[model samples]
Target: MTLDCFCGGVRVTTVKKPEFLHACNCDLCRKSGARWGYFDPSEAAIDGQTSSYRRHDKPEPAVDVHFCPKCGSTTHFRLTERAASTFGDTMMGVNMALSDQADLVGVELRYPDGMAWSGEGAFGYTRESRILGPDG
Candidate 1:
């Protein structure tokens, strides 16, 4: 699948299927405005100019989040090692927010543990799960 930023500056084309899909509650994630679809290292082909941000001092080498260089829209993310594993491959993470037909993706939202923020009142686990599906 191919994911493009709202403004179409950054685009990620991956052949690997996402290992898991979830909605993160970390403050950074919330700020970036992304719903994550975590893929295995081997299943992704990421391109475009993605800037990095290391907030909250994550011990895991910096999560390289990519954004649209032209419009400043957050696009995608990958672990340093995971990005390296692709070595020019293709992967997919359809950003629901920007997707014209996001509902077709059938992605269920999941709560990833260890986030810096919480969705206490924003949403509930069961509600999100039902929307995202069992794989989320």
Candidate 2:
């Protein structure tokens, strides 16, 4: 599926639906208003110009969040150079909020407690997971 930013200045094309979408309640994710769909960098293709931000709150942030320079819409995220060196740049996350509700029907939505996460291992969920419906 292909998704575009508000101004269509940035686009992301995914080869397949994400296994699940993460509705995280972390400082960055909350402020950015992004519902993350994780994929291998190879599973998705990104087009167009973007500006990116790496978190300053952490001494070594894991990913660099990218947004459309024209519309200021959060687009996708890639591993930071430091993070890539340690973890290998195998994963990327697209902001699924860019997708139409109908396009994500039946997609599982998971709520991860990012705020409480230690950034080391699995995190507890703030709530149970649910599948998106036509109305969502």
Most accurate candidate by lDDT: 2
lDDT of 1 by residue, 45-136 (tens): 55667665545555543356667767888776655664456444343343435444443256555765536333233433423354543333
TM-score (all chains, Cα) for each model: 0.63, 0.98
Instruction: Write out the backbone clash pairs for model 2.
Output: none
TM-score of 2: 0.98
lDDT score of residue 119 within candidate 1: 26
Per-residue lDDT of 1-136 in model 2, one digit per residue for the tens? 9999999999999998888999999999999999999999999999999999999998879999999999999999999888889999899999999998999999999999999998999989999999999987
lDDT (Cα, 0-100) at 50 in candidate 2:
94
All-Cα superposition RMSD per candidate: 6.7, 0.7
Deviation in Å, model 1, residue 36 alpha carbon: 0.5
Question: lDDT, candidate 1, residue 59?
Answer: 50
